[model samples]
Target chain A: MNKTTNQDPVVVRNPTPSWRAILLCVLASMGSAAWAGTPLRVCYVDDRSGVAADTGIQSFNGFQIAVSEINDAGGINGQKVEVVSYDGKTDPQLTATFASRCAEDDGALAIVGGNPSAPAAAMIPVASEYEIPYLMLSAGTDNLTDMPAPFHFRVGPRNAQDAAAIAELIARQGFKRVALINNSLPFGTDSAHATEAALKTSGVPVVIQQTYDINATDLSPQIGRLRSANPDVIVVFPYAADGARVLRTLQQQGISLPRIVARSALLNTLRELAGDASDGVLVPNTVDMQRPDVKKFFDSYKTRFGEAQPTMYPVLGYDAAKMFLQAIADPAVQKALAADELADARVAIRDALIRNGNYQGLQGHAGATYQFGPDRHHGPPDQNWFVFVQVADKGKHLVAADLATFKPGS
Target chain B: MKSLNTARSMLAGPALILLVGALVPLLLTSGFHLRLVTIICIYTILCTGFNLLYGYAGQISMGQQGFFALGAYAFTLLMSAGNWSFWSALPAALLICAGVALLIGIPLLRLRSHYLAMATLCFGLVFAGIASRWIEFTGGTAGMMVPSVKFSGHIVSRTELYYAILLIMVLVLVMQNFIVSTHMGRALMSLRGDETAAQSLGVNVTAWKLRIFILSSVLAGLAGIASAVVNRQVNPSFSEFPILVSILTIAVVGGLGTRYGALLGACVVVIAPQGLAAFGESETIIYGVCLLLFLMFMPHGLSGLIPKLFGRIRRKAASPAPGVVKAGEIKP
Candidate 1:
């Protein structure tokens, strides 16, 4: 056997490629190009299984719909876009862990969706650490963009901007004394601070300020304090469930003051939970669904989700995905990608977003337009991005308030 | 010869654990895995403390996460607002946690079993509530950024953090071994078995319980500060129900009375989720099933089953020819 091995050296030295092998190699490359296009992997992190599952699932549905739509449209530059989603469970640590895995292990080019502010803020360090772009979908907290977050861009309006807009609406409505009730969470606290600052600037005195725990079932004491203050209007900052609880408590106390709430309170779930109490409650409207484009998108969303109507959360997700896709589709970004400079392409995508100021989106109908710049990471530069809507007809309808009738300076 | 064998047996578990832990960085170079292992080390410290209280002292603390959150916030506040060094903030955080634990344990540890559990549960809720509501100091629900642990004019990298946390955990394990081998450990063990009987046996039951409680809280505080420094962030949710659940689950899964159980449990609890992460939403269901199976079959936990299995295997190997007697052996 040793003699045979020594004598077979010439046999092992070189084997020229046969015609069959050449054919096989050609066929393999052709099959690869035909069957599997190069995929652009992006990571979607959200709270899909825990406390925030409801909103998280909705945001994911919107994201999935956008992914399908983009893929259906031949994908970005004909490269199939794939999303690797990880359920963050609304835990910041878990979110950070998954974000790191997504960037480091999965080689995800971008990350999107941190529905709540805490997880969104958690993703900032991860984004900076990994040098990947993160798009904020539903988290409206200002702290996300307050610092120098180079790779972070937000599609949602900032809490401060929304609060200031609501304050202006209050001023326009001639409600001099406004009482504020906010959830103790960051979103609510930040909104409360912004409202207080805006109200102070507008010379509208805040009669009372109270806060309730995020999931407080009984807000009677808080409502009682608000009622005793006897303000002309009460502005509340909470999500759907807590906002409904507050409205129900106020109704039980027979307090008839005009109530204004953040956009989150306008959710369909809140209307269902609050029942008749939600009627006449004012909410900031960032998207006019009546617009043709928005109506078309809403109809498609309802059809896709098999529902009668879609909520603002899904729309926020849809817009966020679209914005990311559009940014990546920019000629400069595509050029970088084609050149195989992935890091440069990521940076180019971010710069493209910043350069393309005032990009019209589905939210534009309601004066909320997506824009980004070196100084402005938050979307929707329009300060009056929100108009007021009053729930009417036993919480079944939302009618636009007459903001045009009252002069802003008057 | 017996003494040498006994010494080998005693050092085997820790030596194996240290070898495994030391091999992690060499095996995986990704920051993700490094962070995960660092977190596991922190959890090991926490579980060791938890086992000391729940497994040895017979106390159920549903509020350990409350102590954890306190330590995190205390460290962050001291470092940022008070401008304290990492070394200074760490001890301060642990000291504060120990002092608070003493005061609360004095009144709270008087209750037994489920009542004690309920009280601790309430403590956790109240801690989370206070942290979330006190926006001025705690940053409320938005959470606060933690400064990096700086040493010798240089920020500690992830690799350095791994070693630092590993050193602390090793020291904790050694201390735990010392405690378990000593009379204080026996007193705590007796308390776990029967508090009334232990009291009758001249054991200062209440004092022992409180001492263990303080020690456990300090360990938890140390773990929390380490976590804050490693993650570079702190939030109210750190003390919420999920964290409490994690602490309790790891302790129960690791084994009750064993010293190495804490380390074993930390590995399972921390690594299992990440390993099963590919299952997505169904991951929680699968994890629940795994825990249920472990509890139903291995009631003493994974660590508790090791010795019994090993003893059986050794016995079988030694008596390979049971029916045949050797020349020097007497047949029965």
Candidate 2:
């Protein structure tokens, strides 16, 4: 009984399939294999599940819209464009990891979307290492273009450009003394430096430059100092959340003065957070919502995402995606891809994008035009992208303002 | 016979670890997974040092990430700006980190409990602020790129880096084992249990605590230098709040007092999140739930529960049936 229990069962191997069956299997597989050309894979790395998820989600939506539109109207060189997205969680390490995976595993033709400067900077070396074109969406740090990043391109307005625009506006208004308040992050410091340089060059005296913590809820001390300085204008460089806090604090302390903010301060969330306190604030926005092209894009974005109101981030995403798509659609790039030469195609696309001059984009609505050269990777180098707007109607509307229309001490 | 058994037990754990480490690369094909394993090894080094300080020495350090950032920045600055080779810069960075740790620990180790935590937290915040604000030196939060690690006239590949980190981890493990078996280790453990009583028993509490603190920070610095070499970049964000939270969480979940706890904790903290990354936004929620469950049921941690389980199994195996006569005992 032990032997019987321990004995293995007799092995029975089934005979191989007949030639007829094999033939049928092969034919069936052949019939089921639909011949759709190889997809043009692109990677979208962003903060999909962290504090910056709002911007990431909007950017994803905008990229999706662009992808769908391109696929609907024939894809690049008759190949469907597929997106492989990875959530970076706003972690620089994770973002770098995703960049490598996208380049190595996903075989992405290009990479896009690192909303914050940290992740954007992190993506630079990885993209350069992999020799893939990286289209940065929202990060506007000036250092991104300071070094020679051959394969990197930025679509958003840089801190230097916006500060220069504000300085020009200040100079045109003939403001004698200006007070600057900024957050203590890189964005704030860079903007402060730029504004200071521009103001110095324009012969306008900067009376005080104060900085607060990134997420400080109270700005009374900073506001009090600014009020004491008693400059003709106060320029603030902060994100929407902190900007709202600053605005509300200013209103609470009854320190009323001409205030101006960076593009990020124009967000609807700022208005909602600060409520009526956001009124009478001036913002330098890079996109004009009043333009017909921008309106059409907004309508389509709303239709797709079911969002009645869209923010500036999504438009930036749309422009970045559009620029990449335009590069891929170039005849030289298409020819390289057709030859199945991926590396060549990447190089060709980079060259084509660099050579692209005076290119009008969706952001052109705000007088923003993209021009890239071998030496210049950041788009719209000048202050042509900036438009000053006054927040009014309890922050429900933005009315365009011209510095030329106002007197110095009005 | 006792010496033989001791030798076997001592060799068994490391042999098993060596086997696993050897097999991991063969099993995992993706470069990303390999890189992640390297990261886990680096974190293991950091957590082990943290365990020595917090678990055995009874000091709470909330600013291990600050040391890590210091090491990374020091190494990068030396390599890039000073044009020093990685081989020389690495030791220099570690030494700088040790000196800084000594300066901080001398004053800081005097504080107890939450006050120490707050002090360390402030140090971390100040480190981050300096890294971001000192633009001329630290690149002002845009971060500085590190040169590729070169040794023997060849650039280190990802696999080679992974193995290098693994070798360092093994050496750390051996050192940790040696430390735990010594009288100093007993003194530290005693200090953790009852500080005043340990002092009455002739244990130099402050000296031991400060020494462990410095050692822990040096380990963090080493890990940081390794990280900079691997990533080829260093930034102010390296010392951010999330990294501190991760170190603390790894220490707590890995079984604070055990020798193998840091390794277990590092694996769970680093690899578990990557595994749950497929769930997208809910990854954080699921991770939180898992941590909560672990803390509720296995409060002492995964390493702490192992002995209890093994003892129960051994007792069952060793027990005799009822009414059976023993060789040396008379029946009742």
Candidate 3:
């Protein structure tokens, strides 16, 4: 509770301090809440039951898989990995609360979660304040790793990378003009901004750009405006249901322009909602499904979780959990744990991550590896993190599209 | 005897609440617990404003969170962006909230009951949208950061902030007690009791409603500042719909018109989930059930039930023993 931040003018100038000493004694004791135990604890702070729940739920599923595999394989140096889960409900303030709660109340060694950027940003300061190691699953908003954060790390492609890839595809296809439409959520706005900037830089002029409310059921006006702009291609940033609505309106208006969704809002629900209208929409995907390990992991995820996310979500989750769990198994971390030094254990875990910096898992491009050090947190962005795919079979499948030669609806 | 009861409700109730609030830090040993209690104080302050507006003034606003967010942003921005001191930033924030409420309340106070609720809800949503969309000023979804308060060339600590928020909440309740004890308080009760009748009885209904609205909004702003100081951060989540609903729930479940109901409601809404393991992940469900149960069976709310129970006990105490009918028997 060392958070006194009020502005009392008379009190400030009165040259007297009230009740500062006793408060420190209490907080000092509270800071020692973390105690070493047989079962090591980590907290997963994610949106489990909100609009983007599938992403969080799938990531958590992958996180659980790693925990189970590790515990089954004789634990992290005989100490089983335990996970405490919190549903952030897509709110950053709520996420911050969960972060602090895990640090001070749950005594979590590290916190790993988030499928969105805002919540991820919220966790950073709290993690820094509490000195808890935090690993984010998939918050690819481009600017998250703009500065160096010692205890915070992320595993995902940047929105800027996605935008640049889409722009390259658009230029390669020789499209005349592009129209960009997005939902008004932060994710959408951010993606649209990035994509617009990339497009402008790539010599493709955006003919029209507009945003609709996230919950708007009727998008005919926006779709009609899209038709009026008469762009050769369209890039949309929409969540599942809204994506369906936009597609339906596109069909109704008979605007059969080539549509490219610039981000991860392309979900199974979109295809289900849009029916045949979602047939030819293209998406920039994170998972390169051709890799044997990636394919096997996706197959196991499908068999285990009832449905795979059909994206890079599970990989990101699995990779983060694997790295964190493995880092804790080091002899240095075990020494701190044996001594019941929770504070030292946290610092030890951070050091272990830096020592085991070349963490290779099923995330990023085929050859990409994770890194952590004093000056690096998010690591070097993998330029090849993206793989292009097109929606086919009434949204039942996403077939790989060779951007160099693929044409729309061919 | 009536004066005794009035004094109990006015002075004694708030005094006791303040006493308990003041002693929470020493009793609770954990920083997390202290943090939770500090949050509880913030929510209580927020519900106080809501209580005055909806409870006494006979207005229901689904947009209380809007005022809350406005206050938070104004305070944070003024302090962080304007480099204003905490003392000056607080008054500026309150003034901004009052100004906005006054401008809106003039046209808005004309609407009655649910219509007003709908309009205010829209206001809340619009403000939330602006907080999220207006990225440059509010920091958008990432939220704005607040600097810690310093005093006399020294850093003010967390304990001081906790006490500061607690003191503010108690003062708000005391002020509320003071407000309801005056002639204007009677007018407010009359307005809530029957608006048309109050107007006929020579009450300046519109003027009173506007004043209470401004007052309520200003209080909400104060709460936002307190919360920002505690978290040292303010995000769009401060103005989201779930928060607005929770505040309304606190008002309804604690009995709409009572003075101490805000504290009771804040405790239920804030402490209930964290206190018990079974309540985890089911916070929303518990709140729904609590609201529904209170609405259906105890229509008067928990605050109402307490007094009724007390009255029943008092009435039973005054009843004469069944076998002791000496006076009547002597007459016979």
Candidate 4:
């Protein structure tokens, strides 16, 4: 018997389908597992199935374009990016489940979603629980600010900050009498209340305050009611789509005031959807129109998305993704960060952003900043550097006035 | 003979289900999945309670989500306001829900199926409205957080919350079993099938309806509490009228008239999203399609499918025809 001593394959006629076969099988299994580990691993969950689903879809598309750019640039750390998007269905419970699933199973390092306040409120704890940063693209609630998490960061200004900026603008425009028209949503109600109160404190009295449903098409009655008040300035606090509709309604009603100031929330979909109606309407926004950074952003956005005009949400989505990238790319993070301590990289990124007063974002702005600490969960106080922009020449929205233009308590 | 054998197998179903469910978290090794399972368990408890009313009692109530939301909000308010321990706050939430159920049931139970459904649906919408508008009390639309429920001094993690939810669900199930096995269960079932007939047989239909309504509300409230703790946050949207939940109960998705159908139904509805999301936002399109398919083909839901499948397998295994297949064909 010419048996191989310890090899033991000598007795087997077929030799277990050859060693080459076994090696291939082992290698194949490992290769399959490694393949599972790749794919950009991005997540998009939004209230995309509910009343605001259409706008949510637009916001998600913007984030998709950002991810597309990353992949086109050879992806992060040499791995390709794959986005796993789900609908929160405008439901909070569903959003929480989706957020947790991404963090725990999909190994998603960051998230972008929660167009509505209700869903974002539910997901705040999930972000903390999973120890992954969530960049809320549309949610404007300061609720997340109350309970600080190193992992939670938002690209836009907080509601209170927006309210303060709008108040400052009202003071600058020299509009003493303003009418606040808000939607029935939390954002509208709070913005209306905050803006009204802040303006009141700043010695500007709101002539009329009215609320309407965002889902309603005929804002004619609401507009008519507000028109009766006939204030010099009208501050509309409806969300993107509805806000756009309301702006068109006001224009149709021939109700353009001497000064039209809108919350940044209104500008979310205003420029494109509202068309010429959005022109000449002043908006207090974090977008810095003067900087080369802002110009680069518009050019990049236009090249990638084929639309030069960027919605507030897509701008936010792009900012958040890049911010996440910057956080994870720190040198100390590369040297000392372990798999378990990966969240610290996000923390480092947030800290760097807070310290950076001049973050050259995709948009042409260096003033967009972030601030975080154990006591302060809110973004930078200096993030209040909102510029008053006018929709110039129908197609372009340009900076009408910078923060330096507005004197304090003007 | 087949029915008898099937009954024997069903007697073993709960144990098998529990065994599998208990092992899922360990097997998955993903903290996210564990949290998802915890959510599934929370819904299982709630929909199970609704099952007792709609499936067994023949009542259609849309207000279960209201109870759920109320429980969560109540628990949040109580725990945060008083800095009360979670152990204390949970029972308080249940009692508050039960009390609200009693108050609302007095007027709501007076209405019949569709009217009852509408009324309960209104309650859910109203609760959402209050949560949105009444910012002072309910944290308004921004929502308020319920501090992480603590045990000793350590904050509970999502994994720990999952186990806590599982234990509560098991307890609710055990209690459900105890109730269903007794006279009250038979009486409630009779009322569901025919309140007039039950009344003719000397059953206090109204009283029984009120009792079941209140009991169901209490359980739903408990589920809400479990959900809030597990999710580590409370918002009005947690219970923004679970229309699908109500539909699942009476639709025979789980076996109609079978209490355990609630569990199967919840599993189907809840697990579908995680699996379907791979197809994208059109996952909702899938949900609608599945609803259509279930409505047309499997009217009795998973409950009907389960029994028929098991019976077929047992019949084939014990007495196989020439062309018949072997055992394990029927799933439990």
Candidate topping TM-score: 3
Where model 4 places Cα greater than 4 Å from the true spot, the runs are A1-85, A214-224, A240-284, A288-290, A337-358, A362-377, A380-384, A387-410, B1-13, B154-160, B241-252, B314-332
Candidate 3 residue lDDT tens string, A1-410? 22222231100011111122123445334343545553688888888766667788888877877777787777767666767777777866567766777887778899999887777778887777778899887777555655556688777676767778888888879886888999998778878888889888888899999899989989988888888897888888888888888888898888887888755545677778888888778888777777788888888777777766457778777888888988788888888888898888888888888788778788656886776666677753556567777788887788776555445433
- lDDT (tens digit, per residue) of candidate 4 on A1-410: 11122231111111011112112333222211121344435566787778667556666656656666666677667655566666788777778878876665555656777767777767778887766667676576766657556566555667777788888777866776788888887778888888887897899888888899879988998889888986777888877778778878988999866434455433435566777777666676556656675667667666655654434555666666666556555565444244445456445545554454244454324644555444555543544456666665562554455434333233
Give the winner by TM-score: 2 or 4: 2
> B1-332 in candidate 3: lDDT tens per residue?
98778767778877887787687676555566677678778888889888888888788888888899899999999989999998899899999999999999999999999999999989988998898778777877767777878877877777788888888888888889988987878988888999999999999999999999999999888888887877777877788876886797777677788888887777666655443222445655765686788889987677998999999999998876776675547533
Candidate 2, residue B235: Cα displacement in angstroms equals 0.5
TM-score attained by model 2: 0.89
lDDT of 2 at A345: 78
Each model's DockQ score: 0.25, 0.25, 0.15, 0.32
lDDT of 1 by residue, A92-159 (tens): 87788788777665566788888777787788778876678888776776666865778888877777
Model 3 reaches what TM-score against the true structure? 0.90
Give candidate 3 misplaced runs (Cα > 4 Å): A1-34, A140-142, A148-150, A354-358, A371-373, A379-382, A402-405, A408-410, B1-8, B275-287, B315-332
Full-model lDDT, candidate 3: 0.77
Model 1: DockQ score: 0.25
Model 1, B66: alpha-carbon shift in Å? 2.5
Q: Write the per-residue lDDT of candidate 4 for residues B18-51, one digit (tens) a residue.
A: 6766666555545655555676678778877887
User: lDDT (0-100) at residue B123 of candidate 4?
Assistant: 86
What's every prediction's RMSD, in angstroms?
9.5, 9.2, 7.8, 9.3
Q: For residues A214-236, could you state the per-residue lDDT of candidate 2 as single tens digits?
A: 77777888988988888888888
Task: Give the C-alpha miss distance for residue B124 in model 4, angstroms.
Answer: 1.2
Count of clashing residue pairs in every prediction? 0, 0, 4, 15
